[model samples]
Target chain A: MSLDAATKPHEQLAEYLATDMEAVNRMIRARMASEHAPRIPEVTAHLVEAGGKRLRPMLTLAAARLCGYDGPYHVHLASTVEFIHTATLLHDDVVDESDQRRGRPTANLLWDNTSSVLVGDYLFARSFQLMVETGSLRVLDILANAAATIAEGEVLQLTAARNLETTEEIYLKVVRGKTAALFSAATEVGGVIAGADEAVVKALFDYGDALGISFQIVDDLLDYAGTEATGKDIGDDFREGKLTLPVIRAVAAADPSEREFWTRTFGKGRIAEGDLETALALFAKYDTLEATRRDAVLWADRAKAALDAVPEHDLRQMLADLADYVVARLR
Target chain B: MSLDAATKPHEQLAEYLATDMEAVNRMIRARMASEHAPRIPEVTAHLVEAGGKRLRPMLTLAAARLCGYDGPYHVHLASTVEFIHTATLLHDDVVDESDQRRGRPTANLLWDNTSSVLVGDYLFARSFQLMVETGSLRVLDILANAAATIAEGEVLQLTAARNLETTEEIYLKVVRGKTAALFSAATEVGGVIAGADEAVVKALFDYGDALGISFQIVDDLLDYAGTEATGKDIGDDFREGKLTLPVIRAVAAADPSEREFWTRTFGKGRIAEGDLETALALFAKYDTLEATRRDAVLWADRAKAALDAVPEHDLRQMLADLADYVVARLR
Candidate 1:
């Protein structure tokens, strides 16, 4: 799609950050290359070139520009953010045993799980290498902790996926780890690298954090809302036994018969044909999907509110709109 | 197996670094814990408590002390090195699909490949966190490059493992990646963190590089030298189709009939009951086993020679002796 056709806030942001984004893309290509292992680049290329929005890297660029960063390190941080995001996607596909991502075959399917795992590792290492080039230990510290949190969230999801006892609190923690940690880190490091004051850095973090949460909640809602072109099919999360917010809320409000259905399908892993339709019906009965959507909107509003702490700028407005655009996709 | 009877040079080094090693061990324990994912500690403890030599961390500690560094960051660096090593072992077990390590069932075998992969990733992230705490950009750079090299070596090995056309040069590259990269980084960062001079840092890097190469060659040699307690059984590498030094040498010297045999067994993956015996016979006929042993000794001597540039110290002597001790076990 052309920039003129770009309706999403992130698409417009990508257009605005196009030049710096190109630099980040170039650095990604250069860093992902390996002299000894040709497979590393091959696998990385499959995912990197899959045409998903460069939203995370764009956040880094946006925050840096908002803080008036003039040096080359912001590009480095942007690339670092993308590498970390791509690496996690590779590993997540393996963990989820997924075949399709971004409407294309996953690396594990195109190559093998082994390639996906090792290449993900290479990118993660490369990400660290890029972050160290910024010469800001605070940035490194922020990004490093985010990396650890991302992995920890994935591990937590592994144990929490099939359990009916999973609470919304735990689900929020997982969502934060899987989505928001990188989001917040991507933006926080940008401000920190630009030598922005603590207030602005903290504002960037809060904004990204709220935006990420809203984005993921919408994703969970859309899995039930049936958006297959995004490669996330209806019942994909349900079949995977993931206790996302909608299901967690529905289960909490479940009657005895409804509770038995959830227990049989999700808790006991005895999913039958047409169970997805039944789960959808149950979600409708309790209005949990609408409830989840309301939560997402609230988070997006919080994200926009956090932008108030920063000085007024065009990038800030775009970021505020970006948060709104996340939940806007739902309607 | 009593501590008093631990006659390996590494064991002696461990004794010398006991107090520091205790601190390193404590740091490892503290850092590996995950409040959200109990599975992380369970899987990590399986490998961590299995009584490894803690050799890589010891190298870091030794290098730091030998450079007159009495700072506390060395402990963090040492712990970082060990975490990276432990993390690699976890992922290696998954990549190799191994069932046993160090005479115990592997984490992959004990828990699952999923746990191994995720927990390995967690430890990797944790290691980066620890390294960044050192606040030395150069140290971060060295460890980051080493981590990338380790992953690249692994990916290269994945692509290069079974091909009959794999050469000695490729084998050396893979060996450097899988074994020596971390070793060299573990020591180099120690000196770098201690603010050692250019010559001393280069010497430490050289010592670690040569020592790691020697260490791996001997491990490969011992696999066929028939030591079972080491958990690397005879023909394990052959069955896995790994082209180590002995097999590379044997293949290089094979006659037409032996060529067909090597091609069928390793190249084509048609190993049979008598294949190990035949492979051993071929090694004996060409004396490639002894030839590999000689190569190991040469590298060990090179490792000892690298220490000449550094000032003489008790730890230096222990490191030199450790090189000799790697191959000594084979005899």
Candidate 2:
């Protein structure tokens, strides 16, 4: 299958699920509004309508459809997933103090950190409400556990930031927390909501988890080797001194002077001119970026393999393609 | 009915519920622990063990006991309330840029904002997990709505801050959001988990709602008329330009010059020396402080009256006394 611009897996999924996607969008807008707090709607609209890929919610919808669900509550679940994602982004921007998100000024930068924090909180509560409306205790359990894991992963990443002792184990845990937890929950909840078989649910969860890991690894990789096509500024993780997977691996294999270079840039947060180039040189000497790409590819493959348990449908094929597309940038 | 130091309502209730409170404390300690992130417990302990009166959780326990709840999950519910409270405080410090909470340096001040935000999120998720453990959908629904109301209230207060046009209705809404929603939820969920009858649960809800309103009104009033006994600095709200009840009423009754003062101090956030005194004098001129005090007393009375539906018990009497104690500072 020749993957063209119009044939991107996510885009294809969005088109196939357009009616359901529209319902999900409507539900999101309706729930995000506050009868009392207009700021809730304003801040939520800023992010929700920002045209991000809506990929997480799509995962939820696709998994439900693929599981042969024809229920109404999948819309609620999809909106719940999106709200959680948006809440995390709002808080993440405040934590990162980043001025830009999705090519626009962030809520924290535009409104205030107070709005970002509180509005993020409002959306979290909203998401909780939406999930409860599904009336699935099992679904609630799945999302609640995911919420805890996401929070733990974030705190782990924060504590691990710029620390040379950060291991790949810690990095993977953070990746699971920051990205894959939600992904797995999104897919797992769909299967659970549909009353899918246990094995099928497990397969959905595995697929989401692997795909999320692949997605995050690719993101981290792009911060180093990205072109303009990725819409990422190269070496952002380096500039922030983030101890991502590549850096953690390279540091593990570093000699004395290279260790000193890592210590200066990441540990103490000092970056001189041409530091990006020097870091790239170090990554090259270590081939850690290539190793990171391989890791992403491996997870993508694992994601595709996990789908073997699912009943094969066009949606299932799209999901497999989606997994492949996540790591296809490396090729 | 002379309230002695050792016989304070909360103190007496604490003694009565000591065993359950201990269990709740244990649950809190156990749940707040993160296997991956140590920062969760550290930040939680700083606030949780800081010796702030556990008034909110006590409401949950007292309500449960008063309604004859003998189950183990009331302890879980009480701890859930506290976790939600602690989570809000963590986020509140970051939102308010607060340094001191319960007379100790805040978590945001001690660690960084990232830890506070992420830890707050962790506690929120932990609270969700605890509530889910009870396996009561009604309890979950009640807490979920409370969470939404609380968030909406905070956002409304944020946008309404410094706006002189903020009405008493808006102040009441903000008060409910910041303090009362959780209080009522704490009490209401207890009755719910106990499987109390609808009337008793409604009574518990009303009692908590009125008590929380009275408690917050008194706290706001203390910001103007407080002494050493209240542990509140007089005019802190004025210095912060907050639009609490007394100030809102005073603004409503202000003449052109008084309006100018308010516009300068609050609307423009340009507070200067003697502003607090002038604001107090204006409150006196309009009798708004005394009026606000009356509002607090009325709500306290309402809280006591609402307990009429609750089965007569010693805990009920203590709860009534707790309401009185909240507004006792005015006298």
Index of the highest-lDDT prediction:
2
Q: Write the per-residue lDDT of candidate 2 for residues A28-65, one digit (tens) a residue.
A: 99999889999888888999999999999999999999
Candidate 2 interface RMSD after superposing interface residues: 2.3
* Error of model 1, residue A85, in angstroms: 0.9
lDDT of 2 at A49: 97
Residue A320's lDDT in candidate 2: 91
Model 1: runs farther than 4 Å from truth?
A1-6, A98-104, A228-231, B1-6, B98-104
Candidate 2: Cα lDDT at B315? 93
Model 1 residue A303 CA deviation (Å) reads 0.8
For residue A77, model 1's alpha carbon misses the true position, in angstroms, by 0.9
* DockQ, Cα level, model 1: 0.61
Candidate 2 residue runs with Cα over 4 Å from true position:
A98-104, B98-104
DockQ per candidate, 2 decimals = 0.61, 0.67
